[model samples]
Target: GAGVSQSPSNKVTEKGKDVELRCDPISGHTALYWYRQSLGQGLEFLIYFQGNSAPDKSGLPSDRFSAERTGGSVSTLTIQRTQQEDSAVYLCASSLARSGETQYFGPGTRLLVL
Candidate 1:
């Protein structure tokens, strides 16, 4: 019955540091997705995982960005060598299936790189 949860609702980090953002999806949810949205910008898909299929990381901006889902529930986005451009809201969403389903979002983990 729990909704998605993200930690450190806000993160302030110096440029070039590595940061890990955590996500806890609702129970029994088999599809999860990560998206980044800059101020006033539309959501940019970063990565997604559905059941046992390989994750779709095509939208990951660069090699510095990566994510992993464990036990088919929790996921973490790790940004290596953080940059000022990476300052944005990292949102996590999940649904019962991968297609045609509304994604319920977390409050979001806002990253501010300085």
Candidate 2:
């Protein structure tokens, strides 16, 4: 009955450091998604997981970004060698069982890289 939730509502990291952001989806949700919203840019799809299917990672900006869903409930987005340009609000969302379903988003995690 709860909405999606993310951890460390805010993060400030130095360049070249690595960070891991966590997401907890609503109970029983089979679809989870991660997105990035930059200062002036629209939501940028990062990745998503649906049931036991393979995750679609085509939206990841580079090899430095990756994510994984464990036990079909929680997920973690890892950014290695973070850069200033990587600063943005990381949003997590979940839907019933598919990508196009109505998504419930979490209060995004604001990440600032110095």
Candidate 3:
């Protein structure tokens, strides 16, 4: 496919464990983002990286959630000391530019913490 894609379609972990989710955007794209949706809640933005510029991390809820985009293509989302409350479907999106850009989403990666 020519769209965004994610790995570890599903992940199961215990409280206090750590997990890493991955996203691969379309080639040549310069902007990447990470988001998540909890049960019955709306999608929440986590972080975004654009080109060689400093990453835009204002949307991250806490320091525990972090992401990095390498070479303007692949991105990894890491959750440290996972908690049950962190259970959610993680989504990744990518676009060419921030202004007037249309993001393309990848199949979400579901995380379950017990």
Among these predictions, the greatest lDDT belongs to: 2
Looking at model 1, which ten-residue stretch has the lowest summed lDDT? Answer: 95-104
Q: lDDT (0-100) at residue 50 of candidate 1?
A: 95
Badly placed stretches (over 4 Å) of model 1 are: none
Question: What does candidate 2's lDDT look like per residue over 1-114, in tens digits?
Answer: 778999989999999999999999999889999999997777899998999999999899999999999999999999999999999999999989853679999999999999
The order by descending lDDT is 2, 1, 3
TM-score of every prediction relative to native:
0.95, 0.96, 0.94
lDDT of 2: 0.94
Q: Please provide, for model 3 over 20-94, each residue's C-alpha lDDT reduced to its tens digit, 9 standing for 90 to 100.
A: 999999887798889889976679888989888999899887788888887778999999999988999999998
lDDT of 1 by residue, 1-114 (tens): 788999879999999999999999988889999999997667899999998899999999999999999989999999999999999999999998846988899999999999
* Preferred candidate (lDDT higher): 1 or 3: 1
Better of 1 and 2 by TM-score: 2
- On the 0 to 100 scale, the lDDT of residue 53 in model 2 is 94
What is the overall TM-score of model 1 with all chains considered together?
0.95
Q: What's the lDDT for all of these models?
A: 0.94, 0.94, 0.90
Between candidates 2 and 3, the TM-score winner: 2
lDDT of 1 at 27: 87
